[model samples]
Target: MTAINLAKDGLWKNNPALVQLLGLCPLLATSNSFATSLGLGLTTLAVLTLSNFTISLVRGLLDEETRLPVQILVIATFVTLADLSLQYWFFDMHQRIGLFVALIVTNCTLLGRAEAFASKNPIISSTFDGLMMGTGFLLVLLLMGTIREVAGNGTLFTNLHLLTGTPDMSIQLADSGFLLLALPPGAFLTLGCLIACKNVIDGALR
Candidate 1:
């Protein structure tokens, strides 16, 4: 694919969260706050990029029969590295999102890219695909987290110290906020609205 088309696919047309709807578990569970979303998003991004590049390098040795298990082994290796690195450098953030980090190995988004794109393409293209796809996923997480935090908590980036380790970094907008938006039902509602808005925009453009 052309670079522009690849970018469009990742950012809009075939987004992992909105279009493909892969990886919604962590997308909803940890997206209640901006910091958590950003943290997990970056972690996923790193894993995807590395896994895709590595898979592309070894694609020749992989056949249809061995592809699935080999892909998971490659992805799991990177996920473990990401998990350990986070714990060492960003212990607090690790503590908060560690479970989700471990879960990235099971995330179809990563494995799908490895099997569908990385295994069929050159290293450079696979790496770019991983980056773009990861960025799309990150954008959705950030948007959902922002909406939920702003509407539910009347703040943005609350408890951000968990990620940045800086004091007084959160922006407080109001004393009180809607409680429902902070819960699971609220995530579903926010995601539904987002999908609707995306569809409306796409339809208008078309």
Candidate 2:
């Protein structure tokens, strides 16, 4: 595939968020903060990629009737490892992100790839697809989380310390804050604006 198409597939056409629209439950839930959203997004990405690789390896030997069950087992295994890895290294962030981290097992993103792409494609292609799809979801989460945090709290990155180990790494936007920006409604508004922005960029390129 061409680089341009690869980008389009990952960022637009086959996007886990905008196109496939998978994993909306966690996407809408933990996006309250940039840190929380980013943490969960990366965790999901790792699980998806690993599971896709595993499924691609077993594709030839697996029967069609049992393919989905086998795929889920593989995905669940990776998700467990991912959860433990995150809990060990990013305990605080894990705590902040909460149940959304564990929900990666149920994320349609991984299962969709295993069923739709990996079962047919070569391992290399399947792995690349996972990376791209995972990245698209991460991009959406970060975009929405950043906007909400910035607008609602008057800080672009309120707790950069958690990410950078620096204390009070925040830039104030204004003295007064827009309370609504931190709420659930703000998430929807920010996501809409983000999708609109992506569409505009896509149009320009086209």
How far in Å is the alpha carbon of 32 misplaced in model 1? 0.2
Runs of candidate 2 exceeding 4 Å displacement = 1-4, 163-168, 200-206
TM-score of each: 0.97, 0.89
Q: For model 2, how does the per-residue alpha-carbon lDDT over 1-206 read when each residue is reduced to its tens digit?
A: 65467567877787888767788878887777777777888888888878888899889999979999999999989888887877787776667775877788788888988898889988887887788788889988888778777777776766545645567666778775687878777777777777787788889989
For residues 144-186, write the lDDT of model 1, one tens digit per residue: 9999999999999877787777796899999878989989999
TM-score of 2: 0.89
Error of 2 at 172 (Å): 3.1
Q: Mind sharing the TM-score for model 1?
A: 0.97
Candidate 1: which pairs clash? none
Q: Number of the top candidate by TM-score? A: 1
Estimate every model's Cα lDDT from 0 to 1: 0.92, 0.79
lDDT of 2 at 43: 83
Regions of candidate 1 where Cα sits further than 4 Å from its true position: none
